[model samples]
Target: MKQVEEILKRNHLSVTDSRQKIMQFFLNSKGALAHADIEKKTGENFDRVTVYRTLQSFVEKGIIHLIPTKDNSIKYALCKDDCEAGHHHDNHVHFICDECSKTICLDDVTVPQVKLPKGFTPQHAEMVVNGICGDCK
Candidate 1:
């Protein structure tokens, strides 16, 4: 809880109960989480609208980064310490476990550089590898 509060403070966001709880959830989580996942984990203590707003705020503050899955269901995971507003350094590979369906950040495995066509400006990149995780395998 104290660490969550400090994170919020460092991100220049006002500390609130919802933010603290959400931050703690991310900190303890092993993989990215969807909106429904968070709701279920919190026992539905927070309203859907509140959770949505909190997620948006966290994304804007760079406390978390969006993970886009093949099914189009968006998930979020904690950002690295260097991530900040308008800049996210989570340019690493995300591994999705086939058995458990968990999406974890492979921080050690960075995304390879891609050469784009002329006149194209690359902003951000995401790479997700789907396979059986070590535990499942």
Candidate 2:
């Protein structure tokens, strides 16, 4: 809990009970989390709308990054410490285990650079690999 508070302070975000609980959830998660996951983990203590707003705030604060799955359901994962306000360097690939349906951040594998046509500017990119995870295999 203290660590979560410090993280919020470091990120220039005010520490709130909801934020702390939500941040702690992210810190303890082994992989990306969806809205339902969060709500289930938090139980009946937090309202659904509050959880959604908290996630939105975390994403805007760069405390978390969005992971888009093949089914179009988005998940959230903790961002690296270097990520700052309006800037996120989590360019690594996301791995979704087919067996367990878990989405993990592949920090060691970075996304390849792409050269765009003239007059085009790239803002962000995402790469996700689906396969059987080591635990499943």
Candidate 3:
């Protein structure tokens, strides 16, 4: 709870119950969490709109980042890097375990840069690898 509070304070966010519960969920999570997962974990304490707003605020504050899944659904995980407000420094790869169905962020493994053709520009890139994680092995 203290850690959650400190994170909220450091981010200059109000320490609301909904925010605390949602932040704690991320802290206790081992990997990325989907919207449904967060909704389930947060239980009936908050509505979908509140959860959505909180997630948006967190992302805007650089408290978390989005991961694109194979199903096209989005997932979120805590920012481990020195992510500042309005800027996320995470450019790492994401690994989804086949056996356990867990999505782990490979923070040390950066995404390879792609070469674009002339007159073309790249704004952002993401990489995802599917395999069994160490815990499952």
lDDT of 1 by residue, 51-77 (tens): 999999988877788887889899998
Instruction: Give one clash count per candidate, in the order shown.
Output: 0, 0, 0
> lDDT, candidate 3, residue 18?
89
**Pairs in clash, predicted candidate 2:** none
lDDT of each: 0.84, 0.83, 0.83
Global Cα lDDT for candidate 2:
0.83
Q: lDDT (0-100) at residue 14 of candidate 1?
A: 94
Error of 2 at 85 (Å): 12
Q: Model 3, stretches more than 4 Å misplaced?
A: 82-88
lDDT of 3 by residue, 1-137 (tens): 49788888888899999899998898788898888888887665588998999999888888888888888888888856633333457589999989988888887999999899999889889999999999998
**Stretches of candidate 2 exceeding 4 Å from the true structure:** 80-90, 115-121
Q: What TM-score goes with each of the models?
A: 0.88, 0.85, 0.87
